[model samples]
Target: MIRYGILSTASIVGRFIAGIKESQAGEVYAIASRTVAKAKEAALQYDIKNYYGSYEELYEDENIDVIYIPTVNGLHYRDCQNALLHHKHVIVEKPFTLTSIEAQKLFDLAKQNQCFLMEAQKCVFLPTTLQLKKLIEQNVIGDIRYIELKAGFPGRFDYDHWMYDLSMGGGALYGSATYTIELMQFLFDNPHFQIDGSCIKCPTGSDEICNFQLKMNHQILVSSTIAMNVPLKNEAVFYGDKGYIVIPNYWKSNHLDIYFHNGETKHYDFPYQSEFVYEINHIHECLKQQLLTSPIMTPARTMEATHLVETLYQKWQEDTNE
Candidate 1:
């Protein structure tokens, strides 16, 4: 079995471990945290065989073939770079890095080390998403012309210590933008796009709400709204000449509905125990064949999406004098 090492004790790590188990193609062999107590606690909680107080030890472990980084937004680059330098395959959680340059650098470093690397973008791999993709490609909706998404949750700064710190890559821009941006990229075959957007920051000077519009290929228009301090419909819609599609909770969606102008509606659902399993299993297959990069989650796609987010942040930062 491919041995996986986790690089954080973050709450999300538990879910990642569960996906690994469900994949059945890999095992959570080791985990690490900044503190021994936290590391040990996580190991026991997750049923991992080994634990380390520092990430370095886990990277050096001879048995661990891969590392999963679900660290904070700012640490994604550092952690992924460290793991790759040690010749370990890596799966860094989304918002892969704060900028396109960092994303590009990580992909280059992975190639240099001859190691596998990918962003943990679960949406593109879900059964429902894949099926939706097929339908779009087949023009089932008669040529998609516009896409819209509104995603957010009521998140307060008190509970999330790092979310308001820009230095820590905190903000709705980093926290919530990539999913919509990359989802557009994946669904549209990585089309050329330009972004125009703005954000309203919370009291702590972090973006809590962002509304961006992407002109895709000078044809399709993708409008996105992301709010971290408020609740939204959290849905993505694709409008076409013939009909429209709605995916509730597109991030971890199991179902979708399509409405046609002809007054017909279609619904679809593909339930699963854990959405993470598809991506985990995907990584398993790539590694088994000695592939160093994912074909679907390509480096170019990551860079393009990152560039979009960085550009928007820069624009707003200048306007707000940040």
Candidate 2:
């Protein structure tokens, strides 16, 4: 069995730890936090065997085969690098890196170390998402034309919180916009997306909320929005020439509806869970196959998403400067 170590006490790790337990493909052997108290508390609460006060100590544990780095957005790059350097397969939380350059460098390091590395973008693993992909492949939607995705939650911004710090890469654009981008990638056969227009802001001059549009090489138009100081109502709509598809909760959708031009609609459902067991299961399968990255959530796709995010930020800045 693959023995996994989680490199955080971040709330996100709780879901992942539970997933590992549920899958039974791996065991949550260790959990680490900035403090010994937090680490031990989580270890006991979760029935994990080991706990570490610092990430380094957890990395040094010879028994750990994989480490889940679910830290905040900005820490992902450095944290992932450290985990890989220690010879552990690394799965870091998404908005994978602050910049595409950092992502590429991380990939190079993982390659040199011969360790698996992937950003934990879980939405792609949802059964509804898979079904959608299959439908598109089967030409159920005829020809794809436009996509609109919106994701946001009114986060209580605490200056002390990592999500509120720009240096920590805290922003709605980087943190939440990623869900939309990942969905777009999956729907469009991972097409080459180009940012055509955008409205973005660090309203507090520190963190950003962006509204952007992208143009695919094939003339498909995609619009997206990400915000933090807002209510949580997330959805994605895909419009094709012959039909349209609606994903209610794009990130963790269990059911999606497709509407054809003939006024007929069909619903698709997948196994339901509040956590991301599917992605974890996929990781287990990849490890068993000795694959460095998942075919579904490859490093190349991660870099592409990051690059698009970076491009959106640039356009946002330019708009603000004007």
Alpha-carbon shift of residue 3 in model 1 (angstroms): 0.5
Model 1 Cα lDDT, one tens digit per residue, 1-322? 9899999998888878888999988999999999999999998888877999998999999999999999999989999999999999999898899988889889999999999999989998999899889989999999888999998777456635897777788888888787887787888888888889888887888887889999999999988998887888989999999999999999899999999999999999899988899999999999989999899888877888788888888898789875
For model 2, the local distance difference test gives 0.83
Error of 1 at 19 (Å): 1.1
Off by over 4 Å in 1: none
- In model 1, which range of ten residues has the least summed lDDT? 152-161
TM-score of each model, in listed order: 0.96, 0.93
Clashing pairs in 2: 154-230
Top model number, TM-score: 1
lDDT score of residue 247 within candidate 2: 90
Q: How many clashes (backbone atoms < 3 Å, residues ≥3 apart in a chain or on different chains) does model 1 have?
A: 0
Model 2 deviation from native, Cα RMSD in Å = 1.9
- Candidate 2, poorest ten consecutive residues by summed lDDT: 199-208
